[model samples]
Target: MNAPPAGLEIRPLTIPRTIDDPDAADFIAMTHVRNLVYAETSGHDDGRMAPAELLPNYAPDPAEIRYSWLVLLDGEPVGRVGVDVPQEAGSRVVFWLVELRRSVWGRGVGTAAYALVESTARAHGRTVLQTWAEHPPSPGDRLEPPTGFGSIPLDHIARFLQHRGHQLEQVERISALDLRDGLPRVRELCARATEAAVGYRAVQWRLPTPPEFVDGYAWMKSRMNTDAPAAGLEFDEEVWDAARVARADAKIVDAGRTALVTAAQHTETGELVAFNELVINNDLTEATSQYDTLVLSSHRGHKLGMLVKCVGLLAWLDIAPESPRVLTYNAEENRPMLDINEAIGFEPIGYEGAWKKVLSDPTTAGADTADSSDSSGS
Candidate 1:
C-alpha cells in the first residue's frame, strides 16, 4: 500500500472488467489508491478498513447501472472513477465520483478520466452527470473562528472541472459536531422545539420504518427534493414510496450500517411531519453521518427539523456512545438548516461544490451543447 513509484508514463488506463473478482493484490492496490487520493484531497486520514468492509462495497448495486475504473500508470493504480445511473422511469440522471493521487494532479489525468466518464454516461442515455468537488471558498468569504469554513485553499480539481465545462452548481458547507462537547444546547433546542410544536410528539426507530408510518414518511421524503433550495441545478423530484424506503433501509443494513431515525408526529392527526436520520457503520468509534433532516412545508414553523435532529442525535449517542463526531453538509444558502446546525454546536470545517454537466440530450443525438450548474449540498 505504499505510494506508487515516480517516472511512470501517462496514458489512459483500461478499467478491470471484473473488479468484484479482484485477487488479493488487486484489492489491496485499489483500496490503497482510493484512500491515498481521498486523504490528499481532503487533508484527513482515511479510516482503516477491514477486509469485510472492502468486500461489502465492492460490487455495484444490481438495481442500478454502474461503471467504474481504476486509473493506472505504469501498471500501478493512481486514481479511480465511478458512475451511478439510477433506474427510475423518465430519470436521466447520473452520479459520478473521480479521485486521483496528488502526484498526478494538474497533469490532465483527471480531465481525461472525466472525458471518459462523460462519454460513457452519454452513451448510456444519461442526460445529467453530476459530482461533488472539494474546494476553497472565495477570498471575500469570512471564516468563522471556531471552524475553518471559508479558509481552505482552492485546488486543481476545481479548475480542471471548470475547464471541462462543468459549472459549479451549489456551495455546501461541511460541518462537524463533537458529541463529547455535551448536548446541553441540543437538549435546550429539543425542549424549545417540543414546546413550539404544541400538538406534535417525537418518535424514534432504528431502520425498517414502521409500516404504519411508511406513507407519512414517504410524503415527507418526497418534499425534501422540492422544498430544499437547489440553487440552479436541474434535478427531478425523486419518487418515494414504502417499497423504495424499505429497499433503502435494507441496503443500509446490508452494508453493515445502522440507521437511527427520529420523526415528529402530529398528536391530533397521527401523521409524521418531520424526520432526521443518523447512520453509524460497524466502526462506531469513528464518525457518524447526519443523513436527511427534512421538515414538511406545511409543518415548518414549529421547529420540527430541530426537534427531530436533536432527538436523532440523542438516540445515536445512546446507541453508539463510542462515536466521536457527526458530520453533515448543508447548502450555504440553506440558512434555516444552517442556523439550526450552528445553534446545535456544529461548526463548519470546509466547503463542497456540487458540479453538474448535461451531456448529449437523450432526445437529440450528437447534441454537443452541454449545460452546467451547481446547487445544494449532495
Candidate 2:
C-alpha cells in the first residue's frame, strides 16, 4: 500500500442543531469542499448548494443510520466520507462515498478514506457495499456494465474501484433539460400524455403533501426501491408511511429548498399511481433537480411516467422561473423512461457507475488495498 499523506485524519462530523451553531464550522467547510469537488468534476456549478441548504441532509433520521466524517490533511478539511445503513428489517446493504478535491487526487487520501467506510459497514453488520460515482467524459478506454445501455471511461475512479474488488454493476445517465427554452414542448407532451392516460389525471402539490394524497404518495415512494432498475446492486424494500412522508417533507423544507410533487391519479379510484418530483435550491438561480419518478407496475403501459414528468416540469416552470435548467438521473436500462426524457429535450450530460462489493469476510476485506487517485462524487 502507498503511504498515506502526512497529517491525514478522518474525524467524525458533528451534526449541529442548525447551521448557525458553533459546532457547524466543520460541517460548513465540508459542504464547501463538496460543492467545489462537484463543480470540478462536472465543470459547472449547477449542483452547488449553500451550507444551509445541505445541513438538513446530515441531520439524524430514524429511517437510516448515517455516519459522516471530515477528512483533514494537516488540519485542513480536504474531503468527506459518508456511510448509510438502512433500518429495514434484515437489511445488509450499506451505501458509502468518499469525495476529495482534485488537488488531493493521485494521493492515498481516497483509499484511506474508503477504509473508514468499509470498517463502518462491517461494524454495522452490512455485507453488501454499494457506491455511485460520476465518471465524466474522458478520452480513454471505456467500461460497460452487463446492461450494455451506457459506458464510462476506465478512468482513475474506475481503476480505484477495480483495485478494491468492486464491480461496475450498472450505469446511470445524468441528463439535463434547459428550462430557458420555454415549456411549449412540455405542455405539448403533457397534453398528449393526458390523452393517452385515458383514466388518469395529473395532481400537483408543494411540500407537506395534502392529507388526501399522503397515503397514496407514500405507497408509491416505497415502490421506488422495488420497481426501479438496480442491476446487480442490492436494495432493501423501503417501508414508507404517513409519518415517513412527513419527515421527508420536513427535511426538504428545513433545508430551505422547495419541492413540487406531481402525480397521476386514477380518476375513478382516486389512487395516485405515478409521481415525479422537482426540487430547487433556496437560491433560485441554481438548477432544479428532478428527483424520484416512479409509476406503479400495475399502472404501467398507460403513459403515466411521461404524464407525471411532463406535468412536473410544466409546474416547475411556474414555481421557479429563475431556475435555468433541470437535472435528472435514470438507469441506462430503463429505456421507457429514457425515451420520454429524450423526447422532451433532456440531453445526456454525463454517466455514473453503480459499483458493488460483497464482503465474504469483513475482517479480511481490503487486505491487499492499493493507492488510487480518484474523486468519488455521486
Task: Go through the candidates in order and give each one's C-alpha lDDT.
Answer: 0.70, 0.89
Model 1: clashing residue pairs?
168-374, 169-373, 169-374, 169-375, 170-374, 170-375
TM-score, predicted candidate 1 vs. hidden true structure: 0.82
TM-score for every candidate vs. truth?
0.82, 0.98
Show where candidate 2 strays beyond 4 Å. 363-365
What does the lDDT come to for candidate 2? 0.89
- Model 1 agreement with the true structure over 138-230: per-residue lDDT tens digits: 554332211222232334555555555566667788899999866778888888888888999999888778898888888888788788877
Q: How far is 192's C-alpha from truth in model 2 (Å)?
A: 1.0
Candidate with best lDDT: 2
Question: Which lDDT value does model 1 have at 63?
Answer: 47
Tell me how far the alpha carbon of residue 32 in candidate 2 is from the true structure, in angstroms, after superposition.
0.4
Tens-digit lDDT track for model 2 on 1-378?
566889998899888888899899988988998898888888899888888888888767789999999988999888899999999999989999999988888778887888888888888878899999999899979999988878999998898888888899999999999999787988999898989999899999999898999999999999999999999889999999999998899889988899999999999999999999999999887899999999999999999999999988887877898899999999999999999999999999988999999999765655646675755657
Candidate 1: where are CA atoms >4 Å away? 1-29, 46-51, 54-63, 136-154, 360-378
Compute the lDDT of residue 224 as modeled in candidate 1: 80
